[model samples]
Target: MARSLTAAIFATALGFSACLLNAAPAQAATGTITGLAGKCLDVAGANSADGTAVQLYDCNGTAAQQWSVGSDGSIRALGKCLDVTDNSTGDGAKAQLWSCTGGPNQKWSVSAAHDIVNPQANKCLDVTGNNSANTTRIQIWSCSGGANQKWNAPAGGDDGTPSGFVVTEAQFNQMFPNRNSFYSYSGLTSALSAYPGFAQTGSDTVRKQEAAAFLANVSHETGGLVYVVEQNTANYPNYCDWSQPYGCPAGQAAYYGRGPIQLSWNFNYKAAGDALGVDLLNNPWLVQNDSAIAWKTGLWYWNTQSGPGTMTPHNAMVNQAGFGQTIRSINGSLECDGRNPAQVQSRVDAYQRFTQILGVSAGGNLYC
Candidate 1:
């Protein structure tokens, strides 16, 4: 919608991101810093030279990949430190295996956000061009929260995220860097039980496309997952319909947007609750308070409902109906067919970017 960013949103952005690197400093940390495509940070050729390029390689449990994080913020491997080449603070500065002298350039902070930041440069450890191919040299680039910048270093997603999911925790973090922790990867995976075939019904490419489509639409609705409730107070009391037989039992204002897909209206709560075997009509607050329930509501909408379009988003992608059909299913009435090109473009852009992150083609029919 190209909605205005609230003063409250701007004011809290800084403070909210202040904790990205606030994890207790790695104390003799004993793991590899995993990055793009699940590769590990490796020293080229296992060399101990002062300027050997630090690169991404397939994790082989090798000594070159094994790193011990220092209390003083040095990442050491092969008896050398992960140093920014020549103490450079510039973007594209190559990280190298250099003799540790505790230079500010050698200092690093492993963040909970899955970033290994060189505090001196204020940049994130990045794979040069979002490539995950082995031996791709590593460098420092401005923090973008892209998959190339995520690392499962000390206290990162590897510690808390579940394994075997199509979307790795690092990738999820990359997708919604500013998201509330309440929209957790664990919570999301837990809710997947409700729709067993979602993201699992097709070929690998189709699966990733479905996942990207769903999340792209979700990102639009929730503002990259940063917003939990609808920001417009004026619409709060208007979602209720007195004409329904249930008659907005939760209260007039209670049916306003909430959760990832912003499930609203009295009848919607009743229907979602009935399908999910919960009492959302009478206990709508659960959608806002319970992370699992919140994720489930979003999933329910994606799987079962075809609000203003001809097909469910799930069937659109899995049946090779193309990404545009998914958009039609989600918001065709207001945003499709040129009614709101900007909003439609926003969704398409997100879908393309997310499919790229998942290493899949976004496919055609990207607009309705």
Candidate 2:
């Protein structure tokens, strides 16, 4: 049995309207939709064509199974809504893809029992005949509060984080095959998990570019993740700017270039620490000691700092500002304006390689 009518009424009142006919709107609830026997709701053969059948398949982290549950009540995948066949309300009516029309047949709400119910039909989305086999058809059926109708929908839209992480572990290994003494693949993975939103500030393509841009810069800075701290010990002491109010809590000579992007300066450590909820201002060595922390600091710089550039590296990549802008953002004063073409070229080369690996175009403006 489905939940009581009062519960259904409350869900309807919560605005489970069908999606409008535009590009699939940004979703509030998005993730893999898992159903009977742990199978996922998959678009057949990763196809996005209208009328494609949505079936149950093995859980593979592909775009076909990536669903965005919109606030307007449409469950969408590959930019189309999960719609009923000909707006049929009868039990066993097969579900199919259609351009979203905000129709009653497309408006679905999850009941207290966790059934995905189309209110107009007052029936739950069920695996056809309660089958759990791969390629099992999905249809509307009388609510039985069965496990086949139950699903798990995590919160937040797919902004290309883990679900859309374009780089593979093998690719990462190819980029940093030897691995730094202090940096591990696990560390990078942890950082990626901790800041899943990193480089996801824009569309899927932008996200890939941002990730590539950031890795390219870090590769140039660390000699392919080979070094944990800056090699020039003399410059370490120079990074301790005495003008700030904090006055280098880690000591006069503590602030130095360390971590993936070689985070430097007392103020920078303070800022990265504050953003990551670590006491980096007081324990500057933590950046070098903790691999995950080190990567986080690098990502912190990528996502938040504009440095000598007008925008953050993340913003630069996402806004199609060109890779040269990222160079300006990182070290424009010294590298831009023909100051250090060789160094700039090295970063660009790495970026190009990464983009090639990611199968994305490097866009334009390779130099600052």
Point to the candidate with the largest TM-score: 2
Which pairs in model 1 have colliding backbones? none
Per-residue C-alpha lDDT of model 2 across residues 1-368, encoded as one tens digit per residue: 00100000011101123355756665557789899888899999988888999899999999999888754556888888899999999998998888888767786654323567775666788999889999999999877767888887755434323433456667787777766768776677667533444543334466578788988988887788877777767656677778888888788889777888778778878877887889999999999999989988887777777777789777677668899998888777767899979888988999999988877889898899
Q: Between which residue pairs do clashes occur in model 2?
A: 17-72
How well does model 1 score by local distance difference test? 0.75
Tens-digit lDDT track of model 1 for 1-368:
11111011111111001111213323366678788898899999999887999999999998999887755556788877888998898999999998776566776655544667775666788999999899999999987778998888744212223333468888999999999888898888778756645665434576678899999988877888887777877778877878878898878889777788788777888888997889999999998899989999988888877777788888888778888887777667766888978877888888998999999899888898
RMSD per candidate (Å) reads 17.4, 16.2
> What 10-residue stretch in candidate 1 is worst by lDDT?
1-10
